[model samples]
Each structure stands twice: as structure tokens, then as C-alpha cells.
Target: MFLAWNEMRRNKIKFGLIIGVLIMISYLLFLLSGLANGLMNMNREAIDIWKADAIVLNKDANQTVAQSSVNTDDINGKFDKSEGLKQTAVIATDGKLKENATVFGIDAKGFLMPKLEDGKLFKKNNEVVADHTLKTKGFKIGDELSLSNSDEKLKIVGFSESSKFNASPVLFTNDETISKLNPMFKGDKINALVVKDKNWKDAQLNKDLEVIEIEDFVTKLPGYQAQNLTLTFMIVFLFAISAMVIGIFLYIITLQKRNLFGVLKAQGLTNGFLAKSVMSQTIIIALIGTLIGFGLTVLTGAFLPEAVPIKFDYLTMSIYGIVLILVAILGSLFSVLSIRKVEPLKVIG
Candidate 1:
């Protein structure tokens, strides 16, 4: 360790360059990871808030929520004593805020809906609760928003944090209002049913409907699977590249010190000590680089635009950091192998 420190001190510029490269690559990997997580949350945050164990969709809909249709009567009678909630979406906007928001028609007493960030849940047909994102787009309590293609207007009574679906803010309303807005949906017809029972497969239901785990349901959302798969592949590729870069950098550094290592070996230094020094140096450099990268990522998150979907989770970040360090250590094995092969007599001459 002392020898490794002395070498680093003597060649600060070379080590500094390698550390800088690592910092940049690590920063990029973390940023990409944050974006991937943020986008996934944006796509499924509203559904995740339900905390439901499983979702019931019409088998004919092919696992898609939007296309599925459920009759409230069937769900009520078949799943008696079970908490089954109906939900659906419609394209809506307030003219000033023109985006295709998903209107969720849920029972006010059900557990599927999330608590409001401000104000109360819907108590009437015309009252609605929306995601916090709506507030950012010029909406507030008492503001009346209209649906697209219909003259019906709903008053925003509350806002919930992180309540977004399919990249759009969610608007919670009652069954009555949704039925009034869309003639095709009458009485008990709903897009899907959310059930609290994890053992939904055992529940006796019409053969036409299928039960799917909530986590699996999220993947069925349009483009959700594809987007996540692509980003995950990119992250994996970056991890591989980082490992290779570290391996090459340490191998070259080890080569430059071949004569010094040979002399030390001739002077009675054990191979284990030399290998430990190399690994210790690699770990120190990796730790410094990872810290700098993570700090920069936090700073970037702080200044990022409100419109951009980006989230920083400490657990995820920690996992990423640990993986990076492990890969770097693995990369240092090449240097250890090179050290073991060093011929003390040949290099001393």
C-alpha cells in the first residue's frame, strides 16, 4: 500500500487522467439510470399507487386495460367480500391545459385511490382529484376542466403526488361522471377491475376475464416494455465498457511499473503484498471517481427542468455504485496476474 501510494504521488497526472475518465463514465451511467427509473415511474405511478395485488382484465382485451371491459355486477357478485374497484380513462383537458389526461373512475370509498396531497377525494360526480403534475400546468383547487369531445366539466378538488399514467396526469372521478361523459359506458361498465387479493387466480370468476399481477400489468402499457428493455440494455452495455476501460488502464499502469515490482520481488517482497497494493490502489481510485460522479448526478438532478422525468433513488444509486466498484475490482485482477508473472532476475538485470 505504501509503495502504491508513493507511485501514485510520483505520477499524479497519469492517475488523475484515469480518475477523470472514470468519473465521466460513472456520471453518464448514473444519469441514464435515473432517467430510466423516472420514465418508468411516469408510466406507472398512478397504477402503483393502487397497491392492488392483481388486476382483472377482459381476456378478449388481450391484457390491455384500455380495451378491457368489466361489468360491475359480475365483479361484485363473483368477488363478494373482496375489495374490487373499477377504473377507466378518457382523454380530457381544460383547453388551457390541453393534454390527453387519463380520467380514472373509482369508488370514493375504495382503497385503490391514493390520498390527496391537498384537499379531499371526489365526493360528487362533478368533483375530481388530479395528479400534482396538473398543478404545474396551471390547475388549482376549484378550477373546472372539460373533457375532450364532450361539454362536461369537472371541478378539481384535490391533487396527489406522483399520480400519472401513460405519461399523462391522472384525473380521479366517480362512476357517475364517467358514464355521463361517455355514452358507450353505462351503469356498471368499466375498463378494468382492481382487486386486493394476491390469490386472485383462485377466485371464481367468469372464464372470459383473466387475473394479472399488478406488476405484470404495467408492462402491458403501450411502449412500456420496449422502452424499459432498451434503456436496461444501454445501461448493461455501459457497465461492460466501464469494466473494460478500468482493466486496460490498470494493466497499462502495471506494465509501466514492471521493473519496480521485479526489484521489490528480488528484495524479498511477497507476490500477495504486491497484488494487494494493486487492488487497494484500484479500489481507492474507483471510490473517489464514483463519489465525484454521484455528487455531480445529484447536482444535475437539482437543476433539471420540471418537465423532464428524472428521479434519484438512494437505494438504486447505492446498488449502481456497489456494482461499479465490484467491476473495477474484477478489472484489477489482470494487473494481479501480470504481477505474478514478473521474473525478478530478468527485470533486476
Candidate 2:
């Protein structure tokens, strides 16, 4: 370890370059994770907050929640015969305050709608809740805003924080009001239904309606799979780059110390010690680089825009940190493979 430390100290520029590369790659990975998680949360936070055990939609609607429509009668007999039901909808409407908002039409009386950050839920027709961010965007109680895509208008009745779906702001309103605005809706069918009952067999429920567990429904959101896949690729490529950079840096430094290593070997130092020293040096460099990258990410996230869709979670951080250390260690081991081949006799003969 002392030998490794001294060798790294002697070639500060080379070691610094390696650390710089690792820091850049790790920073990119952390940012990508945040964007992916943030976008997903922005897209589905309200639905996740619903905490529904299961959801039912039209089988023909496929993966789109907005496209799926279930009639009131489809769930009436099934809901009453089973346990409970909560119908939900995602509507694209012009903001009552902002110009364009992707609103989530939730039944005020249902399990998904009454969570308020300020004001209250709809108690009468034409009432709606706006996202807290919209409060600054110019929406207030009793304000009537026109929908951009449709001629229908919605009245802001309350405020809430869980407003935003797929990186767009959300509004919570009764199903009737949303249906009244949407021409496709016959004032009867719902976009989706949340079912709660232990006795209700999912397979049987699917026979009558397109039934899927709540968690699964979340993954079905458009662009979710592709976004996640892209982030995964970024993270994987960064990790590989980190490993290779550290390895190559260490290998170059070791080569520079070939004569010194030969002298140490002649003095009876073991190849194992040399390898351990190399690993220690790599770890030290990696730790410093990672800590710096992590600190920068935290600071940047603090001031990011609400619409930016960035989430920094502990699980992701923990996993990234562990992988970073391991990659650095692996890189050191790889470089050390050349250590055993350095012969003292060849240099001093």
C-alpha cells in the first residue's frame, strides 16, 4: 500500500487524469438516473399515490391509459359484487392558469382524489383542483380557464402537490366533469378503474375487463420502457468507461515504475504486496472522484426546475457507489496482472 501511494504521488498528473475521467462518467450516470426516475415519477406519481391494488381497463385499449375506456356498467355489477372501486382518468386540457396542462381526472369521492395541499376537493359540478405550482402560474379559486384542445372550460377549486403526469402538470376533477368536456366520453365510461378485494380473482376479472395490478399498470405508460432502457445504457457504459480509464491509468503508472519494481523484487518484496498496493491506489483515486461527483449532483439538484424531472433516491446512490468502488478495484487488479511479469534479473543483469 505504501509503495502504491508513493507511486501515485510521484505521477500526480496521470492519477489526476484517471480521477477526472471517473468523475465525469460517474456524474453523467448519476444525472441520468435522476432524470429517468424523475420523469417516471412525474409521469406516474399520482397513480402511485393512489396506492391501488389493481386496475381495470378496456382490453382493446392496449398499453395506453388515456385510450382505455370502461363503461360505468362494466364495473357496476363487478364492483358491487366484489369489494370496492375507484375510477380514474388522464385528460389533456389547457391549464385553468397555465396555457397547457395534462390533467388527471379523478373522482372527488373516489380513493384517488381527496388529497389536498391547500383548499379542498370538488364538492359540486365544475369544480377542479390545480397543482400548487399553478398557484403561481395564475390560477386561483373560482377561476374559469378554457381548454386549448377543446371548447370546454374547467374551474379551479383547490390546490394539490401531486399534480403532474409524464412531466406535465395534473388537475383533479370528478369523472362527470371530465366526461362532459371530452366528446369521446358518453358521460358514462371511465378511462380506468381501481379495484380492491382479496377474493376477486385477477384472471376472472380480466375475462370481463382488462385487469392488471397497479404496479404493472405504471410500467405500461408510454415512453417509460424506452426512457428506462436509455438510462440503463448510459449507466452501464459509464461504469465500463470508469473501469477502463482507471485500469489504463494504473497500467501506465506501473510501467513508469518498472525499474523501481525490479529493485523491490530484488530486495525480496512479494508480487502480492505490489498488487495490493496497486489496488489501494486505485481505490483512493476512485473514492475521491466519486465523492466530488456526488456532491456536485446534490448541489445541482437543489436548484433544478420543478419541470426538469430529476429524482435522486438513496437506492440508486447506494448502488452507484458500490459499483464504482468495485469497478475501480477491478481495474487495479487488471493492471496488476502485469506486475508478476516484471523480472529483477533482466533489469540488473
Candidate 3:
């Protein structure tokens, strides 16, 4: 430890460069982690809030809620308690004002209808509760919304937070509203069923429909799995690059001090002791630099606009910090092994 600290103090610029590289890497990782989480939240917020164990959809729908359409008669006795949902996208026009929204037609008293963050729940078919994000787009309570597709106009009665669907603002309405807006959606048909029962038997549901767990259902959202995997791969590659950077830097430093290590070995210093110095230096550089990068990331996130959605999950960031430290320690092993190869007699001779 003494040797490591003394050398670091003596070679501040050299060590500082490695720390700088690590700091940049840590910053990117934290930012990416927050971004990945935010995108996921934006994609699955409504589903998570539903808190359902599973949902029922058509077999051919491939677990996609928007693609599945279930008839009321098909699931009559299948679930003891369940709410059917119908969905369609509509352009809400208020004079020159225009807003695109995905509408969910749900039972007024069902568990799927979330408690309003602002106003009262919709009591009539023509009234709707909308995602709070719409408020920022200039929508408010008691404002009438005209659907371009159907003659039936609607009104916003309430707003709910985290009510997004597939990254689009959502409007919660009823079957009667969907029936009017979507010509194909008959009063007897629904897109999917949010089943509340966890003990459903295979034979209980219709032969054409299949059950999907909530987790799997979210992944089926359009472009969700592909986008998530792409971001995940990017983050994983960054970590691998971080480990490689530490290894290469230590290897180069070890090469430069080969003769010094040999001289120390000639004075009876063991390879383990030399290795300990290298490991200590790696840990110090990793831990200190990673924390600094995290601090910078938090500061950056504060100044970012709401349009740039970033959700900092402190627990995951903490885990990644430990991971970076461990990676650096692992990387130092190459230098540790190189130190053991140094010949005490070679340098002195």
C-alpha cells in the first residue's frame, strides 16, 4: 500500500490520465443505465401500474395486446373477474389544436382504471381520463376533444400519471367510446382481457386465446425488445472496453517499471508483495474515479430537459460501480503476472 501510494504521488499525471479515461467510461455507463431504464419505464409504465399477474389475448396475436381482439362471449366464464380492453389511436382536435393519443376503453369501475392524479374519474361514455403528459401538451379537465375518425366527440374529465402506452400519451375511455371511434370494434368485441385471476386453467379460456404473463406482455410492445437489446449491448461493450483499458494501462506501466521491480526483488521483495501494490493502485484509481463520474452524471441529469428522459436507479448504479472496481482489479492481474516474471539477477547483473 505504501509503495503504491508513493508511486501514485510521484506519477500523478500518468495515473491521472488512466483515471480520466475511467471517469469518462463511468460517465457513459451511468448515463446509458439511466437512459435504458427511462425508455423501459416509458414503454411499460401502464402495464406495471396495472399490477396484473397475466392477460389473455388471441393465439395468433403473438402476445401483442394491440393485435389481439377477444370477444366478450369467448371469455365469459374463463376468468372469475376480468376487465376487457379495446384500444385505438385517435387524433384529438380542438379547433387548430391537434394531439395524437392511444385510447384505452375500459370498464369505469375496473381495477385497470387508475385513480386520477388531477380530476375525477370519467362517469359517462363520452368523458375520458387522459395521461398527465397530455396536460403539458395543453389539455385540461373539462376540455372537449373531437376525434377525427368518428362523429362522436369526447371530453377529458381526469388525468393520471405514468399512463403512457408504447411511449405515446394514453386516454382512458370506455367501450362505447371505442365502438364509435373504431368502425371495426363492435360493442361485443375487445382487444384483450386483463385477467385478475391467477388460478386459471388451460381449458378454461377459449381455444383461440392464450395467456401471457405481464412481464412477457410488456416485451411484446412494438419495438420494445429490439431497442432494449440494442442499448443493453452497447452498455455491456462499454464495460468490456473499460476492463481492457485498465489492463492495457497497467501492462504498459508494468513494462516501464520492469527493472525497478527486479531491483526490489533483488532486495528480497516477494512477487505477492509487488502484486499487492499493483492491485491497490488499480482499486484506488477505479473507486475514486467512478464516484467522481457518478457525481458528474447526477449533476448533468439535473440540467437536462424533461424531453430527454433519464431515470437514475441508484441501486443499479451502485452495483455497476462495484463492478467497475472489480473489473479494474481483474485487469491488474496481467501486470501482477508480469511482475513475477522479472529476474532479480538480470537487472543487477
Best candidate, lDDT:
3
Local distance difference test, candidate 3: 0.87
Worst 10 residues of 3 by lDDT: 197-206
Error of 1 at 127 (Å): 2.4
Per-residue lDDT tens digits of candidate 1, residues 1-349? 7877887898899999888988998899899899999999899987887777788889999887778888767777454334434445566566666667877777766776777788888898889898899888778898887766678888999987768888888888887887777665776687787877656777887888888888888988888988889989998888888889999999998998899999999989999999999998898888989999999999999999878998888789889998998888898899999999999999878
* Count of clashes, each model: 0, 1, 0
RMSD of each: 2.0, 3.0, 1.9
What's the best-to-worst order under lDDT? 3, 1, 2
Task: Write model 2 residue lDDT over 1-349, tens digit each, in one string.
Answer: 6766787788788788888887777777788888878877876876776666777777887846677777666576565222222223334334433445655556566667636888878767667787775675666776786765556677777888755655566777665666666666665666777766554443355454677777787787877778888888888888887888888878887887788889999999999988888888888888888888888788889998765778999688868977988988887776688889999999666
CA shift of 334, model 1, Å: 1.7
Better of 1 and 2 by TM-score: 1
**Candidate 2 deviant stretches above 4 angstroms:** 77-98, 133-142, 198-208
lDDT of each: 0.83, 0.72, 0.87
Please give, for residues 78-111, the per-residue lDDT of candidate 3 as tens digits: 7767788888988897665798888998876788
Q: Quote each prediction's TM-score.
A: 0.93, 0.89, 0.94
Stretches of candidate 3 exceeding 4 Å from the true structure: 95-97
Query: Which number leads on TM-score?
Result: 3
